[model samples]
Target: MQYFTICAMEDTDLSSDSDLDALINCTLLYAATKFKRKKRIWKSSYLRKRETHGEFRLTSEFSDDQFTNYFRMNRMQFEEVHNTIQNKIYHEGSRAHKEITTKEKLAVFLRYLASGNSYKSIGYSYRLGDRTVSKIVNEVSAAIWECLQQTFLPDPTEELWKQIAKEFEQRWQFPHCVGSIDGKHIVVKKPAKSGSSYFNYKHTCSIVLMATVDANYKFITVDIGSMGRFSDGNIFSSSILYKKIQNKTLKLPEPDMISGGEKELPYVFVGDEAFPLLENLMRPYPKRKVTANYENKVFNYRLSRARQTVECAFGILAGRFHVFRKPFEIKLASVDNVVKAACVLHNYLRMTSTATNVEDIADEELLSDQLTSIRYNNSRNSRNAFLVRENYTHYFNTTGAVQWQRDSILRGKY
Candidate 1:
């Protein structure tokens, strides 16, 4: 009985040791797992803290002048834009527990637009990732376009069109001229899988900006995002402006008497030879090898002088916003937004600033004087168009003639 009692005691001792060993192993495993989880949490928190604190903090330190210099806008302008886009860029911070402020986003985006810096470079300056910089830029650009379109680039009514025509006739000395139309190639990086669709005659990848400018160098109408491979005529025909004019939905003014009521003249937009000569559009006469002293030549010279407005508008846009001067590395949609935003901002700046000199920003040399032969469809309509041109030519030479026009033409100065 004593032996059996001892054996039972030994068995109880061994079972207790086995239970203790299993319990100790379980505790060690739990401790290791807890440590690993804490380490992970600590790492994430450190990274988040680092990301939240950086050069972006310095934005608050800039003075008004510094802000204007950096963002290319005065404080009032900045606030206006920021307030307009604040709701669009605001982040609720629900999932990530971290977010960028709306003001900071605008600042970052404006800096990118003003400087045309690479995403990585902008990220470095703003203490953001390149992806974040790119996202903010695109969002802010799109927001600017959406929020300011109606205010800056509203559709013109008949009175406004007539006013523009009057301005052209008074300032440019081109009677019945409504606006100047032109096209420019905005260079861009080749898009993926685009093949040669974006390749232009200049042997570069680009998108076309077809714009109509009033006498004051403001964009009256603009059509962007056309393939650069297309000619100006092709792009213009496909534009919304063309459709509106064709359908007579644009509310253009009625034909009025010209040259002291001798003949009726329709309000027209003057373009270079790359545009078609329509009932409401005029282009230069095709150059002939044997130059003649015909009225058509004088009319071409006058039309060319008026067409300078659109070219100057483009020059001012590119000069003020250097982004257009460089090849855009963004996607096509982003480029569209950027271009629209720039145009709106251009008009805004022109309307607000008193010291903006067009001569200072525009390169007069960039204006083209050479004319190309335009392809005319519909023979009867072509005859009518030529007749209209002839009437205008006669008026310019007679009743509408300026005192110095003949001298200027003789001096080869037109």
Candidate 2:
């Protein structure tokens, strides 16, 4: 009930010396203070008595039970917990990422991500061998992916789908919308034998990651094995998504909003022009003149609103993993795992953060233009809009495309 405050260390930061001895000693105290729930703890110089032969040492006045009850540790017990996390929790075989503990590994990774530090620089700071530092980072990153994929992503259940449907109505004014689908390229170090196969519009050789994010900006699906040289269109057509659509294996719920309609409405997913048009897939109509003025703009506007989640999700991923910002210079096979880990960590951070709400974007032409521009650039290979047109044609046949036509008219149709 009471908050306790006191400095555990003095002002000189003597606890942060380069020696391993310092790490052992300081980590012990850090674990002790943290375990005790002490709010203020310091590590620095302790004043010495000039009259004494030895430097003066002050006893920390703690409750007699503080050792057993508060710290829950004896000297041996403290070392065991410290060793467990150091050896087990963050022990990625990667030489780049090794540190004292999982917490330390996370700190290093976040620091590297937040500030683009060279491996040598990070190694120097963490007192790890340079090569060891690289392995540490990669291994720790893999662990993050393992944890997140296991904890966060699962096939959405009916309840989850319903929640997604509700969010679409409130946030994007598009009912029955489950998630936004898109692909992003991550720059990577060019492999020895690979050539134009990895080259992308960004003028970099990289891997492409396809993702589906729900209205809340959480990834619901992911496929991350294709080369960056592949167009989003090719990635989509060749992906498991296309297979699922073909096999009818993707079990989707019927939208309640369309329950009363006589039309044979199936569950729908939204994507850009790069993805194949299917009965369940909805994309913008091919660039066409609006017979009903504004209809084209309105449809594009609505589609853009629903599709923004994938863009934001990618932004968060890239911003949080600088490894993605720079092309990786590792083995090509390892690239998939790194991309997978970055995405999983991204979802993990989003779930753990206090800010759970997706950023609200204003409905402005400038924002639309920016989104359109990025899409065009990313989808340049699929410039013909073949997939989008195919889907629109199918939907037109099914719903008579009349309601869509009417809606287009009311909105000055696209």
Best by lDDT: 1
Angstrom error at residue 145, model 1: 1.4
What is candidate 1's CA lDDT for residue 225?
Answer: 93
lDDT of 1: 0.75
| TM accuracy, model 1 | 0.82
Estimate the lDDT of model 2.
0.56
Q: For model 2, how does the per-residue alpha-carbon lDDT over 319-346 read when each residue is reduced to its tens digit? A: 4444555556666656666667656656
Worst 10 residues of 1 by lDDT: 370-379
- Give the CA lDDT, 0 to 100, for residue 72 in model 2: 23
User: How do the residues 278-389 of candidate 1 rate in per-residue lDDT, one tens digit apiece?
Assistant: 7888777766711676566678778878988887787776656557656889889989988888888878777866575554355434433211112232222367677777
TM-score of 2: 0.63
Runs with alpha carbons beyond 4 Å of true place in candidate 1: 1-32, 39-66, 94-98, 357-381
